[model samples]
Target: MATASAVAAPPGEPVAAPAPVPELDLDRYLGTWYQLAAVPQHFNLACARDTRATYALDPQGNISVYNRCTTWANTVNDITGTATINDRETGAQLHVSFPGVPTQDRLDGPTNYIVTALGPDYSWALVTDPSRISGFVLSREPALDAQQWNRIRAAIETAGQNTCSYLTSPTTGGRGDIAPLCST
Candidate 1:
């Protein structure tokens, strides 16, 4: 499970965020983000390949999360979630939640979702938490080339995440196909 590293501070007092982007443009950030790589998580164990996440902004400024992945067992798995900005000033920290589960802040505390890095043209992004326990490499394309991967790897290190912890995720030949295959 992911945990947040928070320094003790008086209630309502200002707190600093770890490895968060200086600013975020939600309009540019919204849309499909393929999961190129990630730190292993129990919930994502079954996701053998083709993991993806789509984001949409609500009128209330909340973000809708649509996550999907292909299992080695040749099945499609998905879940819908929501992310609310934890801090309005930076727009880099967010709190996410799935149905029937407690919010990220409630379950893991604040700073559970942080935009650690972003591509210049919004082609890719790297998200991490203050704890550095969880992270994801997202891209507008279904797959990333070696050069892009290297760039993202550098960004991960810059964001204070462990570069060695990430493993590449497979894809449908960069087609972004969600269909399940019967056999490997």
Candidate 2:
């Protein structure tokens, strides 16, 4: 689990919303992505290993989100959700809603998911919420090289997120060295 609960600005400090990437290619972004690291959330508390998410285009042109992870008991926990574009022009800001998950189903709230940064080749991405409370580090592979990790750290700082808040996720054939992102 992550050491911090939320990443917030200093007391009484006004902070701008986290900006999304200039643009997002939905087609290229749609696929299975390994959850390399993230700010632990209540919903994912049970996840013990092999956390990954898959995105696909539904018939209605919306993005379908399928997330699964292995629990300590060796059971696979799965959840399906939908992602709707919040910024049509950039396609980088989105609102993801999981049917039975209340935390992700806020329809009238600010965009809860923002793709703040992406690798040049779309191989990795940094995501966060408007408040900068929640964040995720996703990659095409379960593990990344040292250089890639450095770049990701820079991106997280650039996005106004606290590197110390991110906790690495464990995965098979990847990294299970769960540690705070800043510790790298």
Candidate 3:
């Protein structure tokens, strides 16, 4: 999951845009999502298993983001962030960041997050930033059946990500709130 570099434009070339998605209902999307797999990032390199994110609506109508995971030696790590809608029409475009980071502006900047794919019943979701530097497969259940995994694979590819490149996150079997469901 890698998009054209945002600053790698060769003189006149236009930067690539994030993948498009249909309408999204943020209300229905607000809940806990287990991370099944992801394209590793430097910040999350220590997250070894049971990675999950929770989304809640604040009184200000913005999204409150809480992400947690277990690292080596059963260490738990968590962080809080905020998300805002960049495009009201689709409700699929957003920019999110933790407090104290510069460039918090959602507009005049990159709408890094795109809801590239979501399950019909909100059972799973595929997320990728505009830069495509990061990608994640999320599910409501800790474990996914074979059929569900197949669909997840398809969703990942649909969002311009390689399934083989994804490092499976342990949800059920690992030592954490949720055991590792998939193997590493």
- Please give, for residues 1-184, the per-residue lDDT of candidate 1 as tens digits: 1112233347896544456778899889989988877788887889988888989987776788899998989999998878888878878888888776544424224558899888888889999887677888889987777677767877876765556677667776673433211110
Q: Better model by lDDT, 1 or 3? A: 3
TM-score list, all predictions: 0.79, 0.90, 0.81
**Candidate 3 at residue 77, lDDT?**
90
Q: Worst 10-residue stretch by lDDT in candidate 1?
A: 175-184
Off by over 4 Å in 2: 1-14, 106-109
Query: 1-184 in candidate 3: lDDT tens per residue?
Result: 3232423568897656556567989998999999887777776788878889999998888899899988876899998888888888989988887775566533235587899888788898888887666888888888667777777777766665566667777777422432222332
lDDT of 2 by residue, 128-149 (tens): 9888878999999888989899
RMSD of each: 7.3, 3.5, 4.7
lDDT of 3: 0.75
Candidate maximizing TM-score = 2
Which consecutive 10 residues in model 3 have the weakest lDDT in total? 175-184
lDDT-based ranking, best first?
2, 3, 1
Error of 3 at 166 (Å): 1.1
> lDDT of model 1 at residue 66?
90
Q: What is the C-alpha lDDT of each candidate?
A: 0.75, 0.87, 0.75
Better of 1 and 2 by TM-score: 2
* Model 2 clashing residue pairs (backbone): none
